[model samples]
Target: MTMDRKGLSPDQLKEMYRQLLYPRLIEEKMLILLRQGKISKWFSGIGQEAIAVGATLALDPDEWIMPLHRNLGVFTARNMPLSRLFMQWQGMQEGYSMGRERSFHFGSPEHHICGMISHLGPQLAVADGAALAYRLNETSRVVLAFSGEGGTSEGDFHEALNVAAVWDLPVIFLVENNGYALSTPVQEQFRCISIADKARGYGMEGITIDGNDLLTVYDTIKGVRDYCIRNQKPYLVECTTFRMRGHEEASGTKYVPDALFDLWAQKDPIAQYEQQLLKEQLLTEDEIASIRQTLKQQIEAELEAADSGSTLIIDTAAELDAVYAAPAITALPTVTDEMPATEKRFVEAIRDGLYQSLERDAQLVIMGQDIAEYGGAFKVTEGLVAVFGKERIRNTPICESAILGAALGLNLEGKKAIVEMQFADFVSVGFNQIVNNLAKIHYRWGQAANVVIRMPTGAGVGAGPFHSQSNEAWFVHTPGLKVVYPSTAVDAKGLLMAAIEDPNPVLFFEHKALYRSISEPVPDEPYVVEIGKARRVQEGTDIAIITYGMGVVWAEDYAAAHPEISVELLDLRSLQPLDHAAIRASVKRTGKVLVLHEDTLTGGIGAEIAAWISEHCFSMLDAPVLRCASLDTPIPFNTELEKNFLAKQRLEQSVEELLGY
Candidate 1:
């Protein structure tokens, strides 16, 4: 047989045909297992195998491929063992995800392939971030990120594409436009003529192609990959195809039009490729039959092996350990009385911490809005850009989700990214990525999200609801994330340094009100204030006031004015890994507890601390565990109203009541 015009030899073409057949056969067996009650569910890519195989085959082995749920052929093309695939489907402990996650929600770091999360668009930015890392590391590798046409509507899609184009990252976004996004048809999903056309808006080339044609897909992807590698730029390719089956096994094809299904069935990619190979005299009918029989037997054997493997029961201890792996505390350069300390503002201290971390680690990258030229929204990263250069300190568009998602990708590529959300309130825009993707990544796939999100939080200076919000509780509630809110300049620098070094995701909330308002003597040398440990601000015996961030100042001020109440002030810097020992010790000594925070009264970190005190140190408490926080309402814009809303008088009154009790 003659070699194909797309540069594939007869053997390579046959191998491509085999790759297409494997996923189809595997899905068919998965459906059978589903019917037999051996599997819980299945999402089959029956008609889109050619697109997956072609796109992956065109990339170099070192280049990364982030696949969606329907792109099983991509895994098969990458030479993933069929038995391991079955093990994943069978939920065995030996699977890639160790049976922790179901379906295609697992990735192989060894293969440089990221598994898909339920939310589709986040991976787009992650792929772009990985590409950025490759460029910085001066590697020839590129990245291919896949998503459905439906995911194009998500904010992450636009953010990722825009960032990739602006930075000229080597990322190829392959969109599988399979006509429908689950139940919604293409016509209803978007008004645009083609999903690929959107790439033009992002200053990147966009191409639409027939995804069902194996050779066409292979040729198009090869050309696109070459362009991305050569120019260090991004390209978007939309592979127009159809989903021949339901979204999942139990979903049924009832929502699909029978006529449309019949129309696409005639264009079955596998059958078409087989006929093409036969027409070219590359394979006989007997050879095709032999290939099918061999694949079927191999799949069945894998299934048998997986079914005989030991089932994985949930390990509670392991689950807890995986949620948050605490970083070890390393000894810092000792401070001597002869060494003078510098008086720096809270923001300056944070900048110093970042400067030190960047100086120490070449892999550290800072990303946020206005972070490069403007030096961040609050100027916390000011002047450092000139010191570190634009490559290390990047200015991202106002895209919180993509910024965080891309940071995760950078972390995956061995680069630590510190993402700054201009305001704490704006973080809600990227809440899904944080709660679902970042927080759950380690627990589900064992991927470390070593990224720090710097949130300027608080309710002062009359910045109103949007700008002034202490939203630390949201992250503290998340299992896999570490939360830190430092009140003083010294702790701010120390904790920020520690957060940068930690191997887990840390939300570093810098009080917006304290940026220029507070100043203290900070160590010039690098130091790491251990995460999850509380600092004893002042030691006293009458009352133990436990707080963090701006609340610590309030507690100190109240104690100074009264002079009668002997308060043991403790700053609980880290919220998630709460210093229970400190809390119990203080409560045991004083027999009085007051949990104060600037966040709203209900469902605040204060409430969690109060509850812990009630549960653990109930007998030691002299008065009912007291709590003081902002009113459970949006922070008012007016200064007077805000003061009334988050009144210090109310806290003083509560303290008086507690002392009386």
Candidate 2:
């Protein structure tokens, strides 16, 4: 049961050898499948199998493994069924990704393995978050994160390392230095001596070793894992290896030199390990041959079964349902009180929601810039640190990508994270993590990204272009993200509570202009306003104005002034799952439509709503679907210019034009 640094016993050595051989044979089969046009692509871990097998085998079963595209041996060592492995490569419905994704971009929650996407470094922070969760829960587990030597150049790599070191999280970062990033050599990637040496900058232990040596890798990782769990800190291990094949099967080894290829091929990890076993008399020639034959037969059988398995049929309805998580309306406990509703500012109501959620759930964590002590840029999170303490109310660095990726890791450990962006415009810094990782996570692997990204949005008060811009369109355009923009104090509290409880990733946009200007009687009890529903502020029959966020306030004022025209105003609280039924009913009665928003005219969310009305309700409409939005230009700093940029006169003019039509 136990093995020392001298190496494993005969049986254990045989098992380790089998782990390496299985993936190599599987890679060979995948190459054949690619050649025969049965599979689309192949990313082999052919020469670096020792790193995958050794690192995975060294970890506890409860610990997590976030593997890159080339870590096929990790799957084999983790006891992933060979049939599912073949199914994944063949892109079948029975695979881990349910045929939604191709390649190794799929993970199993049961196995504690995170399937990685093409983005190289974001998952590092995710692993750090998971390790933080393990530490928080007092679970003696350490997460092993794998990345290429080239990934060290990414900002996320540094961000993850810095946070892991600062927090003393139990995460082991493994960099498989295969000497090439695609076709670029390691010399061209970084000027440093080794990737592991960079860990010194983050105040963590760093080690470099020959990746082809399975015993060294296993011993080093086992020691690192024990140290991390004992000290509750991170460590970096750089495995120096070579890629015998190309990045993928289609990408030939043309970029590599003949001499270098021959040199690495001679030092193949599998051949070297077999020779070591034979020299030590751990296994005879016949035993090694039998093991190889058994693996070959097993892989071939699994490949045949996977090839003949039923393919996935594209179901639009079921797929859409999976994209969005159902609102947790009934799951939340009721708080009944006879007290009157308390009047509060919009920002205060938002803070109240955070306070209520924190009081209700012990696993809730709030993280943002200046939120813990300075309150926030807009002072929305003021006094929260005193109530929840700094441990739960975290003030993170100004690294948006790492913040969001870490929130994802926290979510995986059943902790609800509320991430605040000082301004909505700044979300562009974290777009890849939000759009690629957060939004697509549910649809790609059926994993709910239960994090709320609070974005303070809209232009007003001469804050200039960058500080004040409506960036909801960027998130609304991305599928699998729930977008909410509440306009009132009551709705702010209710919708935010709903977003925090929902299993999907929600982009909660708070209008900065309404933060203090708006005050209303908000309920004292905890409640949830169902997402994907619109509130009809007024009912009329001549023209229907559909708007959201600050546009709802502008439309309400316009409808009040133009009562003679019988204007109906609908406030769309949620944007992604737009209240299409309300939109249709209002448009049906009025027979005229106007879609309004604060974002610029070009490619704004209003354009999508107008186009949808034209396509779906064209027959019932008496006039064209008109749109009212800011001009296609940056919001100016001057009060008059900003007023003109987002003037209510523009919306009224569009409504008049619709009425005339």
Candidate 3:
């Protein structure tokens, strides 16, 4: 008689059993520690161990795997140092994130594992990006993204699935349907019969299987993995299992029915696999006891070794370097007020900056909505597709979150991506991927997201509330992000060059009002202006206008019109890692200073400048630092109302009030 082997030998089956046993024993050890007050918390993957072990083993070891909160078996299966994992749980200095992030909230690039963020769905999009890189490189490596059933409800999950299907990316989405999402059951999460059924909507092939059977997970994923690599297509596999433990140890499982527990108890993956090995004569009862004893002893020893490591404490000075991959841009030598002979608009200079970068770097790809043959909504990239083709200047779906996540994915393989937001307001939809994932990746995992997001921002041309609002303050408050806003065409080109060359994520804000309105003699040759440098538009002794973007326009015009005022205007090219020396020098030169910005008066960037001046430059100030800003209201669609709502309306008056004081 012949039996189905599923291409596995007895030794391989025994090895699979050993691999699957690690997470269960490790989880039991953690539970003992939790009760003893040695560990704070843990998300138990007790009953669903088969999906993690089997799915990880199905793919090649070098391929990428983005694990979910409950997939602790992936870590053990990857053979991560048990000592380091214990240290990570204890917030030791030798842990993966250097104690910056706790628990499974960190990634290990050496192991080709992308870490999980607390947010459920955005990481799925990030996994799609890694697959996109493999597709671009023409490598057969596939990426596995693990998600719980509840995570599929998020828009990001749908967007990621849609992109992978449309692009035919090499990815295997593993949905571990454990019947409960926190306290909410799978029934309340979606109307579909199974998570795999949702794949039909995205035009992808899918399967649903018995997750409690280790053989089913191994067999299904192994076959699906080959299909993904061979055809470069996405496949969804939903493994139906039960989470025997609560969401965490803190959240009790009282809501689950007693009968449900009794039903699932008979289907426990480790017990079923062990019994199968006995029935197949692969292992004896003595060998099973010996394996369990050996694993428990090993866990205790590793835990004790990790306990001996040094504890991690908050070191703000040491942590400062990890926040940004590159050093802050320094001030350059002052230049004369003479213009070069050549000329270009701010948009033209921006186009030149992008074109020059693309022309030089073969690995760079530009992704955005309507940015391909259309050259973007503003035609900033017009005629480029005719030169570089659509693959490099790619048009993307209207999914900001996915695009941002993909940009980070593209960065994983040393390739760079430049993302263009159609309007700055659209960034709200992509905010989590930017602030939570991209910005934090460098600090948490030492992974640099070498991407530039061109924010077509600010209100002036009556683009209304959705299209025209100054939202720079939102990023200014976020750590690990660089903010750039240039006023002149030359500065736009130079600053954009610096942003692209920087090793981390940069939010390049280009005011829509100044794009076509401002023109200057910009040099054809490529050059990089320092990001944190503040350029002096004019020098005077009486007062100084500290501003950026459109504020520079209003201040420069006001100063030019009133020559007798002896005004000095400063244009801050960068916001984060701001040029404090320039600000102090200007404050020291002039007795009075006024902070100006186009954003609303409350909670604007100007407020920070004013507060800093008051704290650091109070002795030099003849009067208090004053702020001139727009009223706290949305930018109006009406032309006249917009003018009334802008800071330019009260700029001259605010300057006069400061001068009089």
Compare the candidates by lDDT and give the number of the best one.
3
lDDT of 2 by residue, 1-661 (tens): 2323355577888888898788898888778877888778888888999999999999987788999999989888889888887787667888888778887898888888887878889999899878878877899999999989889889899989998998889999999999889998999999888898899999999999989988889989999999999999999999999988889877888888899888988889999888887887778999989998999999888777776778579888987787766655556643234535799999999999999999999998888888988999999999989988887898887888888998999877888899999999898989999998988888888777899999999887799989889888888888889899999888898899989999889999999999999898888878878788898988988888888888888887877776687878899999978999999999898888888888898998888888988899889999888888898889999989999998464976787678777
Task: Kindly list the per-residue Cα lDDT of model 3 for residues 1-661, writing each as its tens digit.
Answer: 3335588999999999999998999998889989999899999999999999999998888888999878888999999989999888777779998988889988988888898899978888887888888988899888999999989989989999998998788889999888888989888999988899999999999999999989889999999989999999999999999988999999999989989889999999999988888888899999999999999889889887887887557788879888989653533222233434378999999999899888877888899999988889899989888899887888898999999998888887778889999998999999999999988999898898888999999888987889988999999998899999999998998888778888888999999989899898887766778888999988888899999999999998999899999897889889986999999989999979999999999999989998998899899999988899998999999999999999999999999999997
Return the candidate ranking by lDDT, descending. 3, 1, 2
Q: How many steric overlaps does candidate 3 have?
A: 0
lDDT of each: 0.88, 0.87, 0.89
Candidate 2 vs candidate 3, lDDT winner: 3
Error of 2 at 285 (Å): 1.3
Worst 10 residues of 1 by lDDT: 328-337
Clashes of each: 0, 0, 0
lDDT of 1 by residue, 201-260 (tens): 999999999999998999999999888989999999999889888888788888888999
- Please state the error at residue 305 of candidate 1 in Å: 1.9
Instruction: State the lDDT at 60 in candidate 3.
Output: 86
TM-scores vs. true structure, each candidate: 0.97, 0.96, 0.97
